[model samples]
Target: MAGHPLKKIQCESIARTSGKQCRAKGYLKKSGHYRCRFHGGASTGAITLEGKLIAYKNLKQFKNYTDEQLLIWIQNKLQKSSSV
Candidate 1:
């Protein structure tokens, strides 16, 4: 029996914990990159202003900024979006 042809394309991403190449099979992306499901294979990122704001607020480092600072950042992002 032959192995799955897709198995030949291993993920090229390095694991954050082990710092080694990921061994999972990777899916080819429109951006010409290969990433396994565990490594953002389906992530398209925040595409809208509201989505970006939500993503920013959910960042791990959000604790470092005060509410006023966060509001200022959001306002700035809104301005940029409006300008674009």
Candidate 2:
């Protein structure tokens, strides 16, 4: 039997102790995750409004847009939703 080829991605987080990126290669377990175990692999979702906005802006399905464009999009959407 043939063995499966391993897949890995470099972690996208910076290390606190080293003041540099962790960059450890790891297998992805879920959508849009790129960090290894020691570099925030297990967690999902952003806690703050700013974090949420940033995460939303980076989603793959979203059109490539400037941060200002995304922020404006979010505000318009939220305003419409809240008023309805």
Best by lDDT: 1
RMSD of model 2, in Å?
14.1
Candidate 1 lDDT over residue span 15-81, tens digit each: 9999999988788877787888898548768777567667787788876876667778888867898
Q: Give the range where candidate 2 is weakest over 10 consecutive residues by summed lDDT.
A: 1-10
Q: List the residue pairs that clash in candidate 2.
A: none
Q: TM-score for all predictions? A: 0.45, 0.39
Clashing pairs in 1: none
User: What's the C-alpha lDDT at position 66 in model 1?
Assistant: 65
Error of 1 at 43 (Å): 4.0
Residue range 1-84, candidate 2, lDDT tens digits: 234325445677778989887757754666666768775547666766688688897788666887787778778977898999
Stretches > 4 Å off in candidate 2: 1-48
